[model samples]
Target: MASLWSKISATLPLNEEQFPLQFSNKVESSVVERLRQSRQQLYSNTTSTSRMLNAQIILDISWEKLNTGTWRDVDKEWRRVYSYGCLFKAAALCRENPSEDELLQAVRTCDMGLLMGAAIMDNILQDIVRILQCEVRKSVKEEDEGEHMQVKRRKTASPHVPSIKDGLAVPRIKCPSLESFNTNYLLPLKPVILEGIIDHWPALNTHPWSIDYLRSVAGCRTVPVEVGSRYTDEDWSQTLLTVNEFIDRYILNKSQISPDGVNDVGYLAQHQLFDQIPELKEDIRIPDYCSLGEGDEDDITVNAWFGPTGTVSPLHQDPQQNFLAQVVGSKYIRLYSPEDTDKLYPHQSQLLHNTSQVEVENPDTEHFPEFIKAPYLECVLQPGDVLFIPVKHWHYVRSLEVSFSVSFWWS
Candidate 1:
């Protein structure tokens, strides 16, 4: 297998742009180059025996040798190999006439290889799972073209709003200078709504960050969208979908709501979409306020939040200060000071200790009596409004309409 891979590698030039998989410096460039060639051939749909064997060799080596690093390192490396085309190769190389169980074994082998490469890897590996699932469906469709398959669709429940009473709202300022914001809000860890700050953004005017424009530009790019009413819900899950599919099913179509039930909400939340599709990034300029931090503009981490109305981000705190810029629609935001963590009934679960268990809109007094004592601030963020949330401030957000928000996180 090794000798065959060497021969194959000798035939192709190392094309870094085509294959962006990066191995650590510990691995020789020659080895990385060979693996890239094998992955390319595997996805090229070449059914030659030698090509399959070479792909198997690449998988085997990656599995055996890629296990010595932090989980983050391991995850990066595994995603690199998996995304580059190893899983597809494993599926195609099952056999000339493979049984269903045999094909399943191919998936299992690929899964086991990812685990072997990174022992601490524990994510559902949604990217690989979606690919294999699609492959299985395609093969089954090929075999049963004459038969009609009935698909069962489950509609996810929409979030129910509890009653609300008035509270002190976060102060709203129109185009406050960077010095005032840094001196008053940043220093005091106060939440404030700054209006007229995003009018200059190309996204607001020239770029047309609307549904038609996004579909035209980034429809085919694969993205991870959260599918559920809220992250705190038991049914919460993540799936990979094309931007077009997300836009059509969740954004453009109102078919999600019917007498039967509300459909599963798909939210493109907290994703580094700017990094994935750079063309979209050109539309928005980093705010001057973000530069008030110690680092330069490049140090800011920008993320996107897009979802239908009623999408809720349950009460939670983030480590970095955040400026959430409302781009397309309105959002109802509530914030609690970090000092009130004890009063908010923080979750007892280790994974969610930073999140408040009490639903802020309507707290069950019997369960979370202390929550009412937590002084809170609220605001309805409109398009062109930017809300600054201090680090560790417990915040909850619910969209008032089909919304698109850009968030910049910085120290």
Candidate 2:
């Protein structure tokens, strides 16, 4: 326990010089004073309950400010305040004889702060959360190693049944030289399946992303999930849920399939999950191909897509170039050239301009007669395949089975 506390304490900022309590000049004096007082009370010997309550008050002030303004316009000081409040709350929860639930709460609080807080601040909470996660994993492993190992072995040996689709297939090639890829595919604005590229990823074999492994690493962390069918539906909406709850309610409940198809599909789509959880990030490498564009590696955006078999991404065009890598199961993908955009019947509303009104699988010909004329390239992207999609290329995707894919977007 002492060792654990030492590690936690080491992650905290050393002094006010490292992490000042002062607010910007525009902030009211009373609010700044309250923040200072809260910090002071945390420093002094006080009951953990009192510390947590005081931190909650600070968090409430930050939350109110966040709600009042557009995210981009929100004051940076409030983000810092929110982060500090979470740090204080986590510290209070970690001290003395904290229960397992309290420790887990501390980790979750820190993750929330990291997700929403200013990146410029001294983010000690990230390191603290990492430490707490490791501790929790250790404790959990000791208690359930035998059970989890059996599950992992069973899943690791399970055969992957490929989904073969017949259509005008995307051209395929082995790993190409950067020059060849840029000249033949990237510059020509063509979509192609580059095989044998991601086989070396740890996610492929070393730390195979089995359901049990993912649950062990990130099941407790909260993530936003898209519920209902695809986003084009009137009932489609997003809700925050723990990864474990999402897996159980959506992924594991195969019996809940409706007559038309799977109902209530919950998709964790286009989320920068690697930024929130570092453990999962270490399992995969950023493709070197992302550097072929104008931006460097840091400018690339990585997103995780995990959902059940029937999950669908309505036809849409993204602004940046994309490299969608299949990691777990197969996906049936169809791509239409930007030249055929008019035929696809894109939504006119500015909010949904990038999305198409036509459902590729069940298109209403009377409403969208031109959709039938659009030429397309299609493929079943198996695990270890990387499909390069050029900028503003309209594409539609449907998972053939339970799938997890990572996409890197860059310009």
Q: Which candidate is the best by TM-score?
A: 2
The number of the candidate with the highest lDDT is 2
Backbone clash tally (model 1): 0
Give the per-residue lDDT of model 2 (tens digit) for 271-380.
55998887889999888888777888889999999998778899999999999999999898989999999999999999899999998877999999999999999898
Off by over 4 Å in 2: 15-19, 142-167
For model 2, what is the alpha-carbon lDDT of residue 153?
39
lDDT tens digits by residue: candidate 1, 1-411 = 123233323333354344345577655576577666765764465656766676566665565545556545654554455433354354344435555555545545444444343322232233333344344545555443332121113233353333444557788888888789988899998899888988999999988677656754555455778998778778889886767678767765543443322358889975557755567888898888988888777778999999877777889999999999999978888899898889888889988888888776667899888888888888888889999999999999987667899999999
RMSD of each: 9.3, 2.9
Candidate 2: Cα lDDT at 321? 95
lDDT for residue 345 in candidate 2, whole number 0-100: 91
